[model samples]
Target: MDEQGVRGSGSPPTGRFRRGAAWWRSGPPWVSRWGAEGGRDGGAAWPWPSTLLLTVFVLVGSSFAAHGQEGERAALDPFARVLLLVAAGLLLWRRRHPVAVLFGTSAAAATYLGAGYPYGPVFLTVAVACFSAVVAGHRRAAWAAVGALWAAHVLVAHWLYRWLPPTGDAAVSWGQEAVVLAWVVAIMAVAELARARREQWARDRAERAQAARRRADEERLRIARELHDVLAHSISVINVQAGVGLALLDSDPEQARTALTTIKAASKEALGEVRQVLDNLRAPGEAPRAPAPGLDRLPELVTQAAGAGLTVEVEGEPPRLPPGTDLAAFRIVQEALTNVVRHSGSRHARVRLDKAAGTAGDPRGAALRLCVDDDGPATGADAGGSGNGLAGMRERAAALGGTIEAGPRPDGGFRVLAVLPLDGATAKEGER
Candidate 1:
């Protein structure tokens, strides 16, 4: 049968060959893609250059083995030469069908030896096939190939010792058998080790990819929070003042001028804050260092809101906090106040800050409480908001081990209350 048709026509479709074929193909999907050309890890193409080199090695070795043998015992006819060519050709399919190719080449080489041809590294084809199967994660097929070769060795020795003259290393001694076994075992060992290393590399690459995705998610959330804080409060104030200026332009020129000035100041502050947010996008080492806004800025925040026509009352002292907690607290208050200005209709709003030492004698625990409340008959401006403000505040507070409660108060206003843990937050930030 021709080489291309041999697999289907010359062999039984059941038993060891069938089992081996199934096992070899059942490996990780990537094994099939491992060709000698064009793929990710290694190409799955026929490694022609290497196969040609190995063919030359075996043929040259065969010639050398024949050189010293006496008589017509070592002479090769056209048929014997074709057998060697067939054996080498089968090796070209090694990467794609390692188990099948190994068996085919080994059978051809065994035929050559059994026919009294001079021995060389004719078994080199079998060794190559065995190694390829193992590296492709086909342990069963590789070991099966080795076992079949050993069986072939025994048959070849029994057949040749009786009729043919002993050529180079052809004696059927136990030492020769031992040496053959040792060589096959060594090649299998090396192939198994290579398979292990490749699998480990794949796993490590997957872990690194997952880690990068997680970091990207965290960075996206941080940027969203910054944009919300920078734009929400400032834009709300500016919107209100702009409306006031337009309303008073002719009737009350002096109040209109003051309203326009407030609009200008709010816009300037918004611009500066947005610039800081943009600067933070720079490479870590190049980013400017600035103290993050915290509760200490509440007084300024109140003044800004008052100018926007909201009457804000501030009470109690805000406790010292870790940077993360401080930022969370500031944003919670800012969002609450912004919502009041934009959504709540009442002019009067109240903000309160207080510290709570956790359950009596709880040496390791304390928290800061923040509350913002305003009477509501929310205007149509609230409808234009995307409704992400309160959700963003909740996410920020949760990140620092805090909780936020926000809903309409029974007395006819909306209220936001956040409690942020302080005990371990600062220590954790310091460690980081």
Candidate 2:
């Protein structure tokens, strides 16, 4: 085959050859045509065999051609013809064991050259072997082998004809060889870069998916904490009232009726709160319900604690708060007082809410502070160590852009202090 036919043949079908063929075909029309044909016919699988067969056919045809010039011979010698046949046989195993095929073909070509074979057909076989190596993902090995073969070619050619130096016409030939080698290297590099980029994209997509899942889990946990804190406190109060009613049934009918009334009221309120929470979960698209207990409900909350047999006191005017901050402030005080009733072993507790001008001197915002103190014994224990109660309180405050500190007070009590942002764009304008 002519050089144009050889170069135009592009790559082959299947494996790495298909990738190379697709890349090469993305060029001019001639390359595309050859690539389409070669890729469809698996030309890359046994390229050397196909090339050698074509060479033999051409040589035979050339022998029959009219040649008026004197001392004109065929394009290949007898030994060279035999070597090409051997190289063709080796091509069958190229894909399975490209390294072995490359070495075998290289040795045969060198021997054919040593025996004075015509150089053209032998060079084509060497190029096909090198191409096979590249398609097998062994570009470095192919380059190394080609370099060794070129060095050997220079030495052998010089020994055969001593007057020929390594430069001049030979140097020009080497330059052309270097260009071909560079082209092959570029192809391999491009493939490597494409593969690397694909892997990076996959990794980034996986990380984003993981982040989404984590956020969903956190939201679910927050909802669960809300349900537990609200329901547990209401149930505890109902349980206390019911016990009181049972104890007074025979001794004092009037007191028993009052206790029963308190139980019914607490139960109804607890049921309403629970239904509202469930509705929020089921219909997130629905309009939000009226805001839960905030500063306005502080007095009612304090009254309930007093009814539960704890002396409760309130101090300071709390700032108007954003909806979320308001809910968080109420939850903090509610949880602190609940702990006092359940575990403090104390009779009196104090709640103080304050709003003041910012220490940073910003006109647009103010600080809302809450402090709940109980004259309970030093129950020096980790909040998390006991139950989810205090942890739920902390999470509530933190979610509303606030900070909470809870521990035993130095003066024989437990104190919880939460500072929340108020007077922001979200807060009512006239109230700050």
Candidate 3:
């Protein structure tokens, strides 16, 4: 009845097309409750060619059956042709009003047979309606309508024929009814198989949609963390230098000029990094204008901290690293230092890097340890930070099969410690 197939691909209609589609999908409440089945267009209009063809076939075929039956049944007349027309025409609404069509077609068929019209392809209309209703999930209605029709036909053929049209006819045998029952069962069985397949396709589509949404959400979170690490550290440095410049604008003009230059450099660097991040967002597959910052840029961090009135010391040489691990490592250190400048009163901090188990003769990948510490009593400013920074740090580390620990030190200030695998393969092997 609704052979248009499964729902359309996921790109939804838009503008007037979308509105018109919504209107099509809407229908009478009873149809929804009956669980009518159709294409995405909601069985909006009649299937004219198919319905007309069926009506023509049944009319011609019934005429031949009537001629052969002669006196055994009533002759085909205007009333008999009207019954055929009614049964076939009901199929036009089979997809949108399945249950109604099922009963309507069966009723017309039953009345025609009760009046003693010869048996013919007029039963085809009833079979089509029954198939549509069963596939549309109106199983009980489809079964009842066909079942009641068969029972009524049995009563008419065996006993009631004496009181009905074409009097003096003998009762028909039971073997014919058994054949009719077999046809009914076969039709319902095929409809059930189709319904199961449709439901499975719907389930698969839902799971795929859910997985796609999950991936999109994770990408957005990663980009947000990237933007935060880039802007927060540079902005803090600019804020500190601006304060120093303002304090000595007239009293110490030369020192003030130096502070102004530091702010300019910090702002320019921040802008360049922000633009780079945006470039990746806008044209993801294109090569970057510049490489990502890594341990090689550690000196720049030291110089920026100096402008912010803090002294930072480096303790170990940077290790050879994978590109992903290198970018994650740089962001972790940057976030840790930003926390130190904003939350700790101490003017000094230390950074240490170590290849925990690597050596010239070792063939296996090694873990890299990073530590940032400051001597502090809390400054209490917190710089209005949103508190996502430390959580972001932990998430980045965990993503690469690494760990991070950040808290106040037992002896004096705060510390951020991280240990990361050299590469993804090493991380997975370690996990195993």
Candidate 4:
């Protein structure tokens, strides 16, 4: 599932990093997704914020290099200024062409050093390029840039030491070379860390969004089952009673009055149950609640079905059940009887409950078995096989780590049998 939105951090990044982060996040969606792809050498690759930062680094380093040179000798020539500008400008496309950027920047920096220009951190541009390339997942190009630039440095140093005299306390030393190497390594490490952190954050966010979607789906299913049960059973009974009232209105006034009263009672009951289901949506602390139906309500259910002209027979002692199991049992029976009233041509149905002996690997030691059957047609819509009712029963039973079998029996009727564990071990499994 896609994340609906991102929650901002309570404590966000600060200082220069914060500013950069803001700019980075402000870009269009595609920019962020494309950031780690092939840079300058491929498509439109200038992630503007990063390019801007690189420009600033390059300009500052160039100025320092020029000033240091002038202090030691003379100001930078126009050619050196132009070369530095060109190198910095090329970094604008670094993301799309990282390898090329690394190579071009390394060449410019090397040329500036070789020609005896001011050496005041101008090499920082090449270091930044190498870091960008590595973090963009181009390891070979980054390492190659590092090795080539270091080689250029060695050659430039050798040339200067061999011919040019050391200038006014500015001679390069072994310690300075080690420090520069360390700076390159440090930049690489920081870039790698940033990339890892970013990827991990994206993964965590995706997982949270997926979990939220799954929870929403489950809640919808539960509400759907509630609505179906409350409406199907009660509305069905009321519908039947209303028809009887109309049939008796012309011949028997007292019988018609009784039919109307039955309708009134059924409607009121349905409205109450519907209200209860809706209240489930309220805030947990504010919503008044009631216990869900269980086997104890079976008698009332039978009476309701009888009023609808369906004869329902109940048998066997109701087994002790966990809340989830009990509610599921009641729903299974309720849905089955509703099917009988709506689809089964026959007016009679049987409901059976029994204790199922524990078998091997049965953790509950016993299970509660529920079976509802009707002497309806063996096939067609009247058979009760083609409806959401059976599917809901199966889902409920499966949620409790049990199973339901529903189909037309060989003896010319439809049957729905479910076995649910009563020990509560699997009751919570559905939530998970």
RMSD of 4: 9.4
Tens-digit per-residue lDDT, 1-432, candidate 4: 000000001022211222244545334444444442332234543466765676677667767766665666435778777767766766766666789999998888877766666776457667777777886778788878877888777765655545533354244677878887887788778878876887788899999999999889988888887787788788878878888999999999898998888888889988998898788777545645778889999999999999999999999988767777888899989988887787667789999999988877876668888888888662223232324666677778878878887766777677778888766645475555
Q: In candidate 1, which residue pairs get closer than 3 Å at backbone N, Cα or C atoms, i.e. clash?
A: 34-44, 35-43, 35-44, 35-45, 36-43, 36-44, 36-45, 37-43
- Residue 115 miss distance in model 3 (angstroms): 3.3
For 1-432, candidate 2 gives per-residue lDDT tens digits of: 111111123122433333344432332344444443343334443343455465675345433431321132223546546777776566654655667777777777776555444444455555566666666667677667667666666556555433332122222256665765675466446645654665678889999999888878876877777777677667766766777789989999898898888778778878888888888889978975855767778887777776667788999876666677777788778777777766666779998978866766665357688998887673333222236776777777666556787776666667788877675535332232
Could you estimate the TM-score for every candidate? 0.76, 0.58, 0.78, 0.74
> Which is superior by TM-score, 2 or 4?
4
Q: Rank the candidates by TM-score, best first.
A: 3, 1, 4, 2
Cα lDDT of model 1 by residue, 266-324, tens digit? 88988887777778787555745667888889888899999988989988987777777
- Which residue pairs show backbone clashes in model 4? 39-95, 39-96, 39-97, 40-95, 40-96, 40-97, 41-96, 41-97
Candidate 4 achieves a global lDDT of 0.73
> Which stretches in model 3 have alpha-carbon errors above 4 Å?
1-75, 118-121, 157-178, 357-366, 423-432
User: What's the residue-level lDDT of 18 in candidate 1?
Assistant: 22
Best by TM-score: 3
Candidates in order: C-alpha RMSD to true structure: 14.0, 16.6, 10.2, 9.4
Whole-model Cα lDDT of every candidate shown, in order:
0.75, 0.63, 0.80, 0.73
Better of 3 and 4 by TM-score: 3
